[model samples]
Target chain A: MMKVLTANRLTDGIAVWLGANGRWLERIDHALIARHREAVDALEQAGQSAFHDNLIVDVAVIDVDEVDGEIYPIRLRERIRAKGPTFRTDLGKQAEFQQASAA
Target chain B: MYRYDEFDHDFVGQRVAQYRDQVERRLSGEITEDAFKPLRLMNGVYLQLHAYMLRVAIPYGTLNSTQMRRLARIARDYDKGYGHFTTRQNIQFNWPKLSDTPAILEELAEVEMHAIQTSGNCIRNVSADHFSGAAADEVADPRPYAEILRQWSSNHPEYSFLPRKFKIAVTGAERDRAAIQVHDIGLHLKRNEAGELGFAVYVGGGQGRTPMIARKIRDFLPEADLLSYTTAIMRVYNLNGRRDNKYKARIKILVHETGEAEFARQVEAEWDKLKASELKLPDADLRAIAAYFAPPELQDRAEGWAGLAARKKDDEGFASWVRQNVTPHKHPDYGVVTISLKPIGGVPGDATDVQMEAIADLAERYSHDEIRVSHEQNLVLPHVALADLEKVYHALLEQDLATANAGLITDIIACPGLDYCALANARSIPVAQEISNRFASAQRQQEIGALKIKISGCINACGHHHVGHIGLLGVEKKGAELYQITLGGSGDENTSIGQIVGRGFEPEKVTDAVETIVDTYLGLRESAEETFIDAYRRVGPEPFKEALYGKTSRAA
Candidate 1:
């Protein structure tokens, strides 16, 4: 299973996925996929360092599965967090993601 | 409405200044999240799934037009143009930023409102019967007593940090509209044989992972001893409540561990000492506070009866709204108008800023400037004159607020579950919306009269699912949403924790299951008057189980 490190930004508290470029990206699709032990460990380290630096809070490495070239969270909670509420399509990061795709 | 005095103004101003400094420090990286979390929580700032959610105290569900307008302003200016009213009669902005919270608090304070003691492990905002002063059946207005509790509990040095968060509710009516039995301390204000006001105090009742009905500790405590008696109960709970397990930390567990009888004894022993002390409320002060809640002088608007009759005879929509939303008031000329936030398939308890502003205008025009937030997630204009109800209904219609569903199947009480809450296991709003949409027909809803379908995403029971006529608790099973249905739960004078029907249903099947339950009730009910709760009580869960799961199946 691939893992992605995620946390909410300190100032705005928006959920962000740790991107491959070592930047916290708001879009989960741009998240860094750590499939190996060393990469997962590095992701954890980045999360820990980010926490101490007060860049993010509630850091977690959640399990994800890629199918048909699409990444999706294993847990419903993290999925909701990554996207937005299942009911309200126009409100979360998903909305922005949709907007970016449409554009 | 009780106006904030100078002391209140200074107190709120100082707290805002203090919180502003704390927010600044945290923003500056001087304060860490670990240390700042508690401080932020004390001001009702919660970090939810999407963003920081702020729960502002409504102070016993009572609000004047100015306050309501101010809340609308916050909704428009700070939040996402909407606010969700919770079961505690508090309004929660689902999309508040951490940095904006201080300013929000400042704005709230401008209207004599604050988020203090709203979230911490302290006495939370004291809620009262939404229809307290206007209800025809009420013994007296309960907001005064609730305000007294609010004053006593807010930032009390001794009880600030307890084993867990404590909730207290007051109901002046015998009907138990405040859900007092499900609170940490439930005070039922009543009159004794001598016609003197007092309270029937129930201690250690709460709903969460472990739902328990409160036990009556004192049959009658004099109104004067409200503070003294409550102080003693707090003292006992503070000393004895379990702090070892976060799950078992509520005073309900303490009252359960120490037998209710023994708990009563300890509280009585503690009260004996504080009864004659300075905690005893003076008559003059009590009267003074009560005077602030004095009912507006209403001359006999006897012409309203005929006017309302003619209007109702003409307009079917107006008649249905008045029949469903408006309840009898203390005065014959007026009625308590409940504005159903639950529109068909709409989110329960949510009002957009525009809708809120419109409601405020209606309150200012018709309800003597008073509005109320009901724990059942509806807004109430408690003093709407009968003559002006047509106007109120017409105005509410303009804002999509005139839903003629009060105590009906569509009037659901749902918490912000996985949709927004960080602690939720599944989404509650969609489920509520689905169930509401399924039972959306006004005729069908009236047929299934007085049915409350309360939904919570998790076992935290923020939606009061444990007390619903048909309760749906959403749980995550194998990474999917599974909703368990509970039967026969009620939060009225005769409160009962609902019984789980059987194995849970999937998200798609949950509404069908509710329909099955409602159908079963309709099939077996003796008469239309026998409510869903009453029918479920009489029939037991056997038939409903047979209907939901096959008769061959067993309970989960």
Candidate 2:
């Protein structure tokens, strides 16, 4: 199963994915996927350091799959977070990402 | 529309400044999350699932046009262009950042608003009847007394760190609109035989994991002794209330364990000692507070407006809306208009930035520059001229807020649930949306008159599910989300806790189960005039139970 590290950015409380070289990406698709045990260990270590550095809060690992070259969360909670509120399709990062993708 | 004094202003300013420094310390890692959690919660900040949610108090659910506009500005600037009004009559912005919270609090203070005592173990916002002064049935306005309570409890040193959070609700009318019976301390303003205004105090009422209707501890308490008596109760609870168990620390638990008689005796003994102290509310202060709550002068016309009746005759949509959404005012020419926040298939109690701005505009123009947030999760234009109803209706329609389902089934009350709240076991808004979609027809909703469907994401009962005529509580079973159904609950003059029916249903089957319950009520009702609660009261829950879980389910 595919996995990625996620946390809320400390400054803005927005969901961010762990990206290459200790960077946090707003878009989950840009996340640096961690598949092997060694990679997962490295990701966890980086997450702890980020927390200690006061860059993010409540870091966790989330399961995802690359379907049609698009990353999607496995759980309903994560999926809803990724897509903004289920009641609102016009708000949140998902809407912004979709607009940018279409453009 | 009570203006804040210099003392109140300075106090809020100091609080905001102090919180800013605390936030700075937390950000710099001088304090851990555990150490900073309570401090953040004291300022009404919560770490929700998606972000940091900020709940700002609209004290007693009353605010003016300027405050409402400021709220709109905050929604546009700080949050995701929207805010959710809660059942406690407060508003929550779901996407605030820790760094921007100080700025937000500073902005809120400019309009005489703050998040003080909105959360944590303190006296939360003192809620009052939404139509306190406007309603014809009211004996006196409750907002003045509520404001007095707010001033008393804002940041009292002794009661700041109670065993658990305390909630108080006040209602002045014979018709209980504030759901006072389910609060920690419920006060009903009434006049005694000698024509002296006093309060009938109810204590130990709450609806979380343990739902209990408040008991009337005092048949009549003198108006002058309000503060002393309240302090007495608080003192008793603070000293004797349980602290070993968090869930058992609420005053309701103390009252339950001690028995109502013993609790009343203890409170009375404490009150006797404190009554002679400076806590006794002075008549001059009461008069001053009451002056601010005097009813707005309304123009006298006939019993009903001719223009509105004509418009109702001409347009079906306007007619339906007027029938459902327009409530009677104390003045003959005016009406209390409730702008429905529960639009069909939309999230309950959510208003976008534009919608908030439009509502503020409406309040400024149609009403007396005053707006009210109902505990039922709707906004009210407390005093609109009946002649101007059509114009106001059109304005609301333009903003997509003119949904004509005030007390109907579609006007469902739901918490943020798992989608946003960290404490929720399952999602509630989706279930509400599904039910709203299933019963989309306005005519069908009208046929099922005054059926309240309240959904709670968890046992905390933030959605007031325990008091709903038809309640749905979301619970997690194994890995799947399940909903438990309860029937015949009400939050009125005669408040009763709903009895849970047997067997929980999967998310896919929850709406079907709700429909089955409603259908059973529809079939078994004696007349169209008989409400769901009335019908359920007449014939017990057995028929509905059999319909949901087959005839041999043994729900009886």
Candidate 3:
């Protein structure tokens, strides 16, 4: 079981996940997977520190699964946040990611 | 259509700057999210499931072509190339950056639009009938009073922090197209026995966890006492409305608990104290506000009706669109054309930037450069000439907006639901989409005849599911999503809360169940003239319940 720290960027209200490099990344694919209690605590502390620096808001631990070496949020809400509005696939950040990946 | 005066401009400008600074402080860690939440909400910025959603008030649902175009431009530049017109007759941008909100507000201000009082516990946007000025049956244009209320309620010092949000609606016509009966304060313009213009006031009506129809408090309130009476009502609610439990905080609960008589007494006492105050609009000021909403000078273009009839005969789609979407205007030559935002399988109320621009262009060219956002999640070109119906229909068809299902079955009113809203338990748009697709045929929809299917993702009732002819309320039972069906509810002059029928159905089975109910109604109807609502009222919900759940299932 893997968990990752996720929050909205305070400046832009964009969903960002805590990366393996300890920086907030917009794409969840780069999220740091916390497998141990110590790792989770460290990620939580890092998220708190980011809050103090006003880097992110509404930080929470989100469940994720690494399938075929690609990280995906397990919960529906987190997945929606990672992508965009579910109703319109062509409009949200998910669409931008798709466009970028295609490019 | 009301232009912002110097004072109005300065007020909005100052608020934008103040919000900009607040955002700055929040970003710089000077303010915590807990502390900044209310402040951001006060400025109509909400952190939804994904991003910050900005709801800009379309005061009384009126907009000019320039303002409409600017909204499209903002949608293209700042948002996701589209916007959702909310049920409160306001527009919501689902994806607005918190850092960019100040700039968005600044841009909105340029168009004399703002997100002030759009959210928060304060008095939200004052909405009126979309066909306010042009409605043939209207006693007076309600937008003037709605505008006056907007000016009075915007950033009011006293009602800033209420127990819960308050919604006010005004309707000038007897038809009650504004759904005034379900608002916190529903004002219906009326003429007294002496033939003097006044208002019949209804208080405490709201649709949420507990849907309650407003009780008529005043038979005829003098036009001069409009603001003073409103101020009194708000003051009474502000003081007496529950603050302990958020669910019971709405004025409807206050009116329910205290009883209508006691509430009316308290309001009257408050009115007695405040009726002669500075809140009372003078004759001169009233005239000034009313002037902005005077009907447009319509030309005598009734002569071209023969041509329009010929075109309608040639095109079956156009004829159907004309029959369903076109509304009779106050002027004989003019018609109110409703552009359905609910295209087949499309998200309700979602309009793209290009579609918006095209709509604006059509408004400018055909409908006196004015547009209206109906509370039913549709746009109205309120003054299109009857002769121009063919051209407008073709133009709308090109944009894939000519759904021709205005008040028919497919024009659904749905909240952002779980997909976009943080508070939703189940997704509403998908369900709406599924149902819309189920009833995709124009011929079938026409046969079904005027069925409103309102879907809400939660008990908040933002989708107005409480008052739909066939209301679908989504609830989370254990882990699975279940939809509760309510039958025969209406949000009209004869407003009634729909009764729940039998048990909740699984999400996949909900649309099929709705189809079953519609089929039952069709079978039981007296004639083709007997609409869904009328038939439902005449025969009650027994047969429908039997069709939904088995014959053994007891109706609630």
Best by TM-score: 1
Locate the minimum summed-lDDT window of 10 residues in model 3 chain B: B547-556
Q: What is the full ranking by DockQ, best candidate first?
A: 1, 3, 2
Best by DockQ: 1
Q: Which candidate achieves the best lDDT against the true structure?
A: 1
Residue-level lDDT of model 1, residues B206-321, one tens digit each, is 88889999999999999999999999999998998888999999999999999999999999999999999999999999999998899988778888999999999999999999
Candidate 1 — which pairs collide? none
Alpha-carbon shift of residue B138 in model 2 (angstroms):
0.5
Worst 10 residues of 1 chain B by lDDT: B547-556
Query: On residues B1-556, what C-alpha lDDT tens digit does candidate 2 reach at each position?
Result: 6898899999999999999999999888898777887898999998776688999999999999889899989999988889999999999999999999999999999999999898999999999999888987889998898999999998999889999999999999988999989998999999999999999999989999999999999989989989999999999999999989999998899999999999999999999999989998899999999988888888775645777778899999999999999988888789899999999998999999889999999999999999999998999999998988999999999988999999999999999997788788888999999999999999899998889999999999998899999999999887468999999889999899999988889999999999998899999989899999999999988999889888878834
Winner on TM-score between 2 and 3 is 3
Q: Chain A in model 2: its TM-score?
A: 0.88
What's each prediction's clash count?
Answer: 0, 0, 0
Say which prediction, candidate 1 or candidate 3, comes out ahead on TM-score. 1
